[model samples]
Target: MNPEKLAKLQSQVRTGGKGTPRRKVKKSVKPVVKEDPKIASTLKQLNVQPIPDVEAINMFKEDGKVIGFTAPRLSANIHANTFVVAGKAEEKSPEQALSDMLSRMGGGSLGPDSLSQLAKLTEGLQAGASGAGDVDDDIPDLVASEDVADSKTDLNAAD
Candidate 1:
């Protein structure tokens, strides 16, 4: 080959090592979602009243676990018999829960009426918990052979 042509071909091969460098792909922009104005207006039309002066909401589970919501936003609609409680719920330890209840009671004294109500609640809860495990006479314990055969026949007929 001629020296000039060889030099020109070598230079072209070196320059065209990889055909093209890839461009960095841009991240897609997320579209902002706005609430529908019509729905907003409809919600506004509902005569939902705000309930004030509620500091905390506590839910006591059957297993002694308590879900406490401090600084709750409480609201109610009397006509609809609906209540809305919005808050950041936090599970507290048993000690914390006891103290919270004590604090709510100011004097740490439950009156006779309150005590009776508490006793009733406990009794009811205990009864309900025990009742769940008991076998009732109404529910059959064993499946009859004839009933099983009948169900199998029905299934075979469908096929």
Candidate 2:
């Protein structure tokens, strides 16, 4: 290779200017603004705790639920009772959803035997779907069947 070409290549590699593309700078997320100080104080009085580490809370949330622990700030006149706000767990994967559902359904209380049943159900569903059968069967027929069934049951019971 020519000395000039080699030097240019070396410079390019060193400076990351030749083949490397420039990355777009990310816009910073702005903090949520509470318009009313009275509302903020009310919330503060309710003893809503600030999450010590938001990143840790995020990690805890990944396992299905987030548990926040915080002491009320001394300045605020908080109530004696502790208040908790629970939001739905956001599952990114089917496995996570299944795990979360099982946990919610008292899988821990049922012990290892419950896990076996869950595994069997998962396997059966997978096997059933692998065939020519409709995948929609996995989903509850909420639109028509449930309402029809409920109406019929209600009518029969009324009679």
Candidate 3:
């Protein structure tokens, strides 16, 4: 072998064919679900009955927010007063919610007294919204006014 050819061959490093062979891992097709037997057993033993014929359910939250559920599945355990409502929760404004509640109550018939009370309530709400004036405009000027306080006190007076 020629000296030049031998040096060239020695400088090159040997490697496995292509690269290291990778193992084909089998992935699970179904997800693994974990359940608690304690809660499940007691819930199954309860005599919870379904509340049928309910059109929808509305829940009122703070800040005049309303949560509504349409065509919900309502179940109640009358013995324990435990109720379960399952459905898709939605958002509705206070006006829409009030209208819906009225419509549900006896086909939306309002007497004279009910109309007057509603009108009064709406007027009260509107009066509070009477545009934004200057923040300190309504506050009276606070000055420490004590004109009649006795200023002369004897330091060495004996009782």
Candidate 4:
């Protein structure tokens, strides 16, 4: 082989020899998502209404001295506000948004009413289990063996 050709082939074989450096591929960056100004303005305009029935429940007491304190949960009546936002955002309904919020608050979508209903259901079940409930006097007796035989004969006739 020619000396010049051999040197050229050797250079090509050794990648790090710098024969025309490989081009680096540039990565595409995802664009930042901006929040809708209208939604922001609407949310800002709507004032957060505090829950009226919420009261401070005593959490911890050391020798009558309250040491630990649990903050009262604050809520807003965002019913109307939620509808406007949901409509503008083209997302879920206001009810769905409210249910999602309730679910996030550790209560299944049922909220406060669920606790009462659950308690009633539990009480009813307990009463039924204790045998204090009504007897099955109204329940009819099972069909006799003759009736079973008649039913089998009817099936054979259909075939």
Best by TM-score: 3
Which stretches in model 1 have alpha-carbon errors above 4 Å?
1-46, 93-95, 107-159
Candidate 2 minimal-lDDT segment of 10 residues:
54-63
Off by over 4 Å in 4: 1-23, 48-159
Tens digits of lDDT, candidate 4, 43-150: 567755545544232222212222221245444546654322121222333333333445556556674686575556556545555554455657687866988899
Residue 106, candidate 1: alpha-carbon lDDT: 55
Worst 10 residues of 3 by lDDT: 150-159
Q: For model 3, name the residue pairs that clash.
A: none
| For model 4, the run of ten residues with the poorest summed lDDT | 60-69
lDDT of each residue in 52-131, candidate 2, tens digit only: 43221122332233343223222222355554333333434334444555665574465778778778866754565455
lDDT value for candidate 4?
Answer: 0.50
lDDT of 1 by residue, 1-159 (tens): 899998676655452245543334435689997757974465467656668888788887756567898889776677878676777899874446656666587566767776676667656666766675675659667857998899999999999
Which digits, one per residue and each the tens of the lDDT, describe model 3 over residues 86-114? 77898986556666766677588877876
Whole-model lDDT values for every prediction: 0.69, 0.52, 0.66, 0.50
Task: Tell me each candidate's TM-score.
Answer: 0.40, 0.26, 0.42, 0.21
lDDT of 4 at 18: 66
Query: At residue 155, what lDDT does model 1 achieve?
Result: 100
What stretches of model 3 exceed 4 Å from their correct place? 1-43, 106-159
Q: Name the candidate that leads on lDDT.
A: 1
